[model samples]
Target chain A: MSFLLWLESTGFGTFVRESESLFAYPTFIVLHTFGLSIVVGISVVVGTRLMGLAPTIPLAPLNKLFPIMWFGFAINLFSGSGLAAAAASTTIPNPLFIAKIIFVLTAVAVMVVLQVKVFRDPEVDDKPLDTMSKALGGSLLALWLLAMISGRLITYIA
Target chain B: MNYSHIHIVLNHFPTIGTFFGLALFLYALWKKKQDMQIASFVTFMVMAVLVIPTFITGAAAEGAVSQRPGVNPALVALHQDAAIVAFTLLVLTGTFAWLALWQYRRFNAPSQWTVWTVMGLAIITMAMMMQTATLGGEISHPEIRAEGVAEVTAPPEGEEGIAYALQMWMVNNAWVWPTGETLHFTGMTLLFGVMFLVNFRLLGMLRGVPFSAIHRFLPLGILGFGVTMTSGVLMFNADFHRYVAVPTFFLKMFLVVVAGISVLYVTIFDDTWALGKGDGTALRHKIFAVTNTLLWLGAMYFGRMIPYLE
Candidate 1:
């Protein structure tokens, strides 16, 4: 608890919490918002495609989106850390915040599984999606939605 | 011109343009002219882009007139309510029209469902546009209110019927604002993702895939924009005073216009449309792609800075 309190009192944390400069908390929040959009947005498109929407879109080429998603993930990781550090004492103990982290992490794990098992398949584009792939896509979508919901609710609930 | 003047000037385009586009579309259907059909589709798409500014200016116009002695806040509210519904339908019609055009480019003809969908949406949207226009006129032009306008009771001095209720609900409910924020961010993600895919393609990132295949997903981006704009208006309505005072809000709005117009170039221009697998983009198209990406980034940046800047 003291460590968390110390983290919250650090210069970066203080800047995030109390700085009037745009580069401080505002910039972190902006990055977080942008990152969320990219990661969740691409996930939705890919998820729907797996469930058979926009079938004409060739699957292999969609590997391009993963790199972009990773870039977004990087931004989120950095910005989310800044935000968490700012409110470490309060947010670290909040169950809602923890749920958000779990949802996001699980969603990321699902994305990796899809990338390896589904997207890496040589026949991904040539054949219809199998039941397992479709189920994975559905869960990926569900998990992301949960992540978004919990993330948004963190402000209100805590 | 002031926002009121701009609103008045721009408002006619969506209403009258829809009528003209619908008429031309019907004639094109009868004549079986693909060029004419494409022309109407382009008109619908341009109007969609223009409506963003028109709606924004309408809010500014309301601010200008709402405090006047005889302005009637209730009438303003009624107009706003009608405008929201009309704006939604118009955006949907425009999206369908874009889908039709994309289908035409890809399949040599738009699918039957897409064609019928645009027609149905256009017809209904035209009617709503007219209704919105009538309500808008009644807000200031008492001469046009007519005897039948009495059906809309003047709520108390500051209260607007549905609009007032919605504003209060948004303010009072803790969940509503955060929900709006979530959806707004979701919409932003959708718009950004689509923009990233399309713009990156133009910048030569996805070289092997044909632009047409990626073009198929443009509607999703437009849908995202539609969502963002709708939720944005709701949030703005809930807190217009604070929003209007922020300089960054104006900068963000300006960037939106530039970015909105720039995206249309990618949508309708033959230069980018003709790009197939392994085809490099022309220098000019690449420049426009970079400008569009930066404009979008600027819009998001300024939007996030709205509260902090002021």
Candidate 2:
């Protein structure tokens, strides 16, 4: 509770909450929203391809999106921190917030697993995705979608 | 001249251009000439390209006419609303034309899906455009609203009463806004992800890969745009008054038009999709590519700032 209060009172937090400038809170929200889409949305597209949606799309070309996924993640990291800081007292103890964080972490883990086990392998590009690979893609997609929903619900439930 | 004059001059091109393209496309299909089909597809895209300027001038025409005597504001409003919907559909047809062109360039023929979808969308777009044009004519000419026909009364205000019922429902629902926010982001991801790849190809990063290969994902990008556009309309209708005087919204719309034209430029210009490339070789191509990138990025930024800025 004390830490929450301290965080809420910080300059960054106060600006995020109180600043009327377009560059502040609103920009953070926009960045966060676009970032969420790229990170999770790219994964969904890649996953869909793996699960046999638009098989004609080259699997190798999709690896180019990994850097973009990371870029989105970085944006989200900063914007998310700003968001949490702005309402630290409310957000810190909120069960939805906690669940959102957990989902985000798990989603990231699933993405990493898919990235390492499936996307990185050059041999898998020409061949059809094996059942296990398809399942991993499907799992990662579900995790990210759940994470997005949870994150969206945090403000309402909090 | 003024916007009204400009609007009058440009307005007929889209309608006429579409007919010309449709005629050729139909002829091509009847004759079973693949080359003519490709040519006709190009014509449809050219027609789409023409729509940008015409649609932009439409708002100006409305603004000009609103100030004049004997014009019914409600009728103008109806025309403006219909124009927005028609413009959206027409642009979608443009996107389909781009895919068709890309397919033709790469595979020696356009995809069957692209062919059928463009035909269907073109028909729909033509119907809507004709409706919008008629409404617009009613605003200025006043003859089309002759008392004998369907009532020429101004459309009633306040969500147009039940025409906007679904919009009202979404607005009233708490979950809708948040869901919209989440989906809006998802849409951005799909759009930007594919766009970034396309621009990089122009920048010469993805060598040896035909532009058509990346172009396959254009539909995905369009789908994303549709999601965001739908969400945006829902939110705007929820509280339209807040936006009437907002310069940012207008700026966003203007940039969207410019950004849209830039996309069409990238699509129709042969230099953009040429297979033998290591970065766009020509200075003009490079310029167009860079401009296209900046325009899209600018449009996105403006869209994001709509609620925040003006």
Candidate 3:
């Protein structure tokens, strides 16, 4: 925690903290949000599809969107971390803060699994997702929403 | 004077009112065994109806606030003007909600055309909401504050750096404010669309559907969160403390983090909730899902109130 605080107070942290330039800190934050939309948006769509909303839509092609989903996650990785660093650089331990970090780690892990199990075989064609697939989708959906709600809580709780 | 009063009433009323209405709707969705669906639908209708009074009273409040001392004439004007647009959007959103409910009853299950219409209206309503929210932010924060196209030009020299920085950022960023504002609005729709479905799923209103399939909508929710975070950061970069330090903003962030983590946990640890098993199988899953939705909603509502609280 002390090291985290020290890191936040460094010159880089100061830059994020004090920079008047719109591109510096604000850009990262904006990027972070965009990433959130892509990643979470994809999750919701795929998860719901797997659950059986748009049964007519093929599952395999929809899976193709996985790369973009991961890409969004990547954006969040870079931007969210930067914001966290900038934030932790100055302040003391924010417990709710720790919770957000933990959530991100979990979200990433689930996404990685999704990529491997679901989208790995590009040769696959459109078919209704199997029960296992639905389960995965349900779990994925639940994780994303939990992450989102918790993320929102950071604004108020801590 | 009238503008100020209108601003106060219009601003706070819709916000709190929306929360209540949404709460009722969610409650209805939850108790699916009962006539919760009908109750939820009714709650939404009432919410739509409330929009009218909220809009009118808001106008009166805005009239009262416009005359306050040290107020920027330009900002006051922008706030008033934007209110008309936002109010209009809210009315439209309410109407759409009513229509969507009507269609749901008529066709049973959301019809393709009805879904499209609701989606379109949601998008437009979101845009209007963003403009209204931006205007509301400007009423007090004034830092990097922009309403519509005109930049809130900086005050005379010797003005505080915070104010100057805000003005400079607002002026320098080309279309960032408007685009960011639009994205913010879109985020709300995404949040609502995905979340409501998730909520409905839990309550058994959407039982035939597998919870996993519902998971696909997670991306849309993410999209909304992304929009919010992006727009929020743009505003934050312009002025961080104004909102970040506020309790409302703080609480909102906390809820978001909770939602995010919970989603991740459920996804990876298949052990957490049995997938594809149908509803009522996993109490834990239901609790978490329901809790997550509520938190996200809370964050959004609180965020909408930042300006009013000040």
Model number with the top TM-score: 1
Q: Report residue B61 deviation for candidate 2 (angstroms).
A: 7.5
Q: Tell me the tens digit of each residue's lDDT in model 3 across B163-256.
A: 3455467658765565556566556657655665555555444444555555545555655655665566456545543653456665665566
- Which residue pairs clash in candidate 2? none
Q: State residue A72's C-alpha deviation in candidate 2, in Å.
A: 2.4
For residues A1-158, could you state the per-residue lDDT of candidate 2 as single tens digits?
Answer: 99999999999999998998877799888778667756776676777667876665566656667887888888999999998999999987888788778878877887777777777788766786789878877887777767777777886776
Candidate 2, superposed: residue stretches over 4 Å from native: A53-64, A126-128, A153-158, B1-10, B27-36, B39-69, B77-92, B95-99, B111-117, B143-145, B148-151, B154-163, B206-212, B237-241, B264-290
> Which scores higher on TM-score, 1 or 3?
1
Chain A only: list TM-scores of all candidates: 0.95, 0.92, 0.84
Interface quality of candidate 3 as DockQ: 0.06
Error of 2 at B289 (Å): 5.1
Worst 10 residues of 1 chain B by lDDT: B150-159
Q: In terms of DockQ, which candidate is stronger, 2 or 3?
A: 2
Model 1 agreement with the true structure over B139-202: per-residue lDDT tens digits: 7788888675735666675555555677898999888899888788778877887788788888
TM-score of chain B of 3: 0.43
Worst 10 residues of 3 chain B by lDDT: B265-274
Task: Using lDDT, give the best candidate's number.
Answer: 1
Write one digit per residue (lDDT tens) for candidate 2, span B1-310. Answer: 8756878887887777777777878888899988777776776766665666576566556555777888776777677778777777777787788788766765667789999999898888889888888877877675667573334555455556332565678778888889887777666666765666667667665564456566656667767766766666566655555654466665666666666556654554576656452333556656666886676667677767776775
Ranking by lDDT: 1, 2, 3
Against the true two-chain complex, what DockQ does each candidate achieve?
Answer: 0.51, 0.36, 0.06
Identify the runs in model 3 with alpha carbons over 4 angstroms from their true place: A89-93, A122-128, B1-310
